[model samples]
Target: MIVRCLEIIHPDGDYPVAEFDGIRVGGVYPVLEMVTDDDHCYIRVLGPDSPDPGLEWDPVSFETVDTRIPPGWTLAIAGGRTRLADARWQRPGFWTDYYRGDPQARADYDHVKSELLAAAPPREN
Candidate 1:
């Protein structure tokens, strides 16, 4: 299944509508649009077992893992794969662009998911 993305409005606002495969699967963001705001928020996509027929807003859960790039590699947005190459990291801000850097592949949803998964500080084990 293709992992789609949607914009997450904040300050308690409605999430933009999302569409995939011409199917109006329930979502809280738009398929393609400029996202504004810098609240360290998230852009979520529903899973297969999403609560359909109901839009009950609820906090999502995730897993965590100790991970980070080698300070030079970049993330593959389309596939969530990382490759060692010269990459320019962008500053924290409202990111409207789907991908990072020139010749952008796609937005780094995997990276975002990773961050969310590890939102809690990692424990040395």
Candidate 2:
């Protein structure tokens, strides 16, 4: 699906983002991936300064921090794939490296996220 959104700064919409299943996405935060099935959408979010350990998304709200990374939080809303790709590419650093598809980025992010998830509290289900 095409990632379209009215920017608050500039209401006119822009590029489409990609999802976890490999579609496009767009948002304030760089969306590494997204999952939209049924009426719900789940996105793998990354932060600017931190690893952005995963979150337990209940399809509506996020209550669990799956990764060891603290100060982690989920933005419940999402947009089309790669919607922010162009804008993101223009400015890069930290977790944004992964969003740009840097080969080592996935490994580096996975390593950190995995360790955090392991150390994190167990999930309810």
Q: Could you say which candidate leads in TM-score? A: 2
TM-score of each: 0.19, 0.30
lDDT of 1 at 3: 22
Candidate 2 stretches greater than 4 Å from native? 1-92
Task: Name the candidate that leads on lDDT.
Answer: 2
In model 1, the Cα lDDT at residue 84 comes to 25
> Model 1: residues >4 Å from true position, as ranges?
1-60, 68-70, 73-94, 99-125
Give per-residue lDDT, candidate 1, residue 46.
34
Give Cα-based local distance difference scores for all models.
Answer: 0.29, 0.36
Cα deviation in Å at residue 96, candidate 2? 3.2
Q: Model 2: per-residue lDDT, tens digit, 1-125?
A: 11121222211344332332211123223333344545555645443332344321222322223322232322232333222222222233535777777766667666645543444443222
